[model samples]
Target: MSTPSKAKRKLRDGVADIASLWNSVVENHKGENPALQQRNLGMISRVLGILPHLVALMFTAYIVWIARPGSSLFSWHPTLMCLAFMVFMLEAVLLFSPISSVLRGAGYTTKRQWHWMLQACAVAAALTGFAVITTNKYMAEKQHYTSWHGLLGLIVCCAVNLSVAGGVSVMYPAIVFNMPVMLLKRLHAIFGTVVFLGGMVTMWLGLCSTWFTNNVHHDAVLALCFACPVIVLLYVMVQVGQKIFRRRAH
Candidate 1:
């Protein structure tokens, strides 16, 4: 072959190699984003999330089983109360489906935002449950039984929410999910931190600070329970933030 023709042939081969390499990179990227690869609650968390509802259902049945006209559970009010509790558990099942879908369908940005929204919703839902139970118990003059059952139910709710958070963190590493999920997670993390610290401070004020009163004991235990969620929120935020910042620095 002529010298000039040989040089042209070499250049053509080099271009083909580069094109092949680029195509491989693109294929790998697509592979990573497959629908089946979506972050989801692992098997254990799904089981734990359902466990409380099952236990609650059994306990409700037991209450119904043991009740007589004169017994606490047989009264019209307690029957209604137990029914409401069951309905709330059913509501949780309905809500969890959408929550799981959002977590799965969402890109990084949406996931982060959705996660924050979910957490906020969980906290609000918890508070709402507490308020409803407390007010109803006070009005019904069934504070003792109502308080115990309501507290147990709230604790179960918190456990499930916390487990969901854990599943998200474990299944989706903060760095990889960061770009697809984006800055929303960072913003949510910061906001969650602030919300948590503020909640803790407020609870302290209401329970042990100057705002506390003789009757505060009724609310004190519940207020203290709020600390766990606050701590979990802070920890997740810090770990996720660190992963994000490290990636950015790289």
Candidate 2:
């Protein structure tokens, strides 16, 4: 073969190898949980796990108390969406970490089952919430996908669906769905985080919506709504990055 042709062939192979990175995350799965790190992780886990639920609860309370939204079916949209995105999805992310030895086989794999189940609920609720909002918009003769909230929500919804699909796909035996295990793991981690953060952003946008702002115009409440989930999310990100991802200290 010509030198240039050989070089081109080598380049193509290198690109493919880079696309399919090694699955080092699995190697980190086995370890003794240092009493100290486990104790610290336990507290962080509690905080990370609880804050999203707190945000969802407060939002639900706001919907019920201040909004007192009439029997209109549209009232279900925010509450259900918040429950699914902020609560269930957050639980799934914080609970089902791939690289965390503390999470694996906890309770004879009860955690894995709960993780799967929570995501299933999140997907169902998100779809139903989307349908409800769309129907409400049409019933009121308002335009669809016209606002920033709608656009961002739609993108996050798609991300949620894709994340769910990827999660499911990777659950089967390797022979059943032939794909690179490492690639699937990376995709799942990256996409799951996207869905988590994107869902929060979408909810924040929802809070910023004129419809919501007009009803509960308290700046303090808005700050609360933003602060709760974000604080937890930042903690999770920083902790996960330090522990899971390859770091200089490692």
Candidate 3:
């Protein structure tokens, strides 16, 4: 056989071996209690749950380091926006995590309190960031919402506020007597997910901005930075989707 052919065959064999090993491991757990069967998967999920906090903190710090908040009025825009969506909003959603919430030991009421508190912080930071950017643009005599990032950001801000209002209705269903509490909760989750997705997209667009392109010179580093939020998004969606599905099943 040719050298290249041998290398290809070896790679295929390696992949097959790994797949076979994984299948065997899964088979070993067959007939076990459902929770017992999911022990390894749960461990992985717990680790994934913890990763968003670290990634958000690191990504926010990187943006702040580049933007250098307090250097000027414009500086605070990126810093505050990143903190609002990446840290506060992310944590607000994760507070309800069944397996890995930092407050998993706490009662549902406690989790609900913290969730809204973090969301309020996110809203405040987001609105303040928006105001800072508007003022910065006004002082510079620049056009507003010209770029995709700015336009989408405006929509995200509006949607976030609306979602928060929905959350209030969910929290106090008596406020909206027409809708059932269960229906209100479902609507809030759906709307909140959309807003969160918009915020992530806005962040991704910000990474593609001239400022980020110029500041982050290394291509590999920029790609890794882009992957961070995407990873968080996937984990969050999976967690949220499972809950929604389970609730529907019940």
Candidate 4:
């Protein structure tokens, strides 16, 4: 009945109306029209697509800065390997991503060409990094592949080279006429994913190395660096797995 009481009631009603409108929006986003939901998913995927590129670039830069490639022969190992696996190889894999590829607008043939080219760069960097570490170890009269990081890195390097060789067969299925081209592609994707994950694990192990532990004093920074590979690995796996499964289903 009073003027102030009437104003308070009006304000409460206005707040309730706003809350109801917000709830409607949230519910609509959750389960609206099928097409709208699909579009929203596409948008989310596209946004997430940029994540790997940013993470890879930042992580590689951090490692390179810490390694200071020119400081010592061993320093080049981490620097080059980080660039190889984290940057080049990641770009190569993402080139085919339907949602987030920078070349999503390009033809499949164009994407394939760039894919192999990027992969070649990755292989070159990896080999050079391997050689650097080998020479450094030799100069110091140290044993090779003594640590988990060293052994895994050796395996990843060899596997990556082999995977690239297999890609040739995928590119030219006639070379392996016995196997279906589709099958070859699937196999290549699976093998490549495994090798990529191995490389990431090796990178993580490298982080655990005495050099990294001594150099990186901040625990939070160390934790974030550790997560870099994990995020990339999950993104790649999800993308590759979805493609493989969708193909199989159809």
lDDT against the true structure, per candidate, is 0.45, 0.71, 0.90, 0.93
User: Superposing every Cα of model 4 onto the true structure, what RMSD results?
Assistant: 9.5
Between prediction 1 and prediction 2, which has the larger lDDT?
2
The ten-residue window of minimal lDDT in model 1 covers 93-102
- Most lDDT-accurate candidate: 4
Tens-place lDDT digits, model 4, residues 1-250: 9999998899899999999999997877885888988898888887798989999999999998888878888999999999899989999999988776989899999999999999999999999999999999999999999999999999999999889978999998888868998999999999999999999999999999999999899988999999999999998999999999999899
lDDT of 1 by residue, 126-235 (tens): 45544554575677787443333344554544554554454355446573454454454454444444434343343233234222243234554445433433443343
Between which residue pairs do clashes occur in model 4? none
Those runs of model 2 whose alpha carbons end farther than 4 Å from true positions after fitting are 1-56, 67-70, 97-108, 173-178, 239-250
lDDT tens per residue, model 2, 64-96: 565444567887788778778766776666665
Better of 1 and 4 by lDDT: 4
Go through the candidates in order and give the clash count of each.
Answer: 3, 0, 0, 0
lDDT for residue 221 in candidate 4, whole number 0-100: 95
Task: Sort every candidate by lDDT, greatest first.
Answer: 4, 3, 2, 1
| Better model by lDDT: candidate 2 vs candidate 3 | 3
**Model 4 segments more than 4 A misplaced:** 1-43
TM-scores for all candidates?
0.28, 0.69, 0.84, 0.84
Q: After superposing candidate 1, which stretches have Cα over 4 Å from the reference?
A: 1-121, 124-181, 209-234
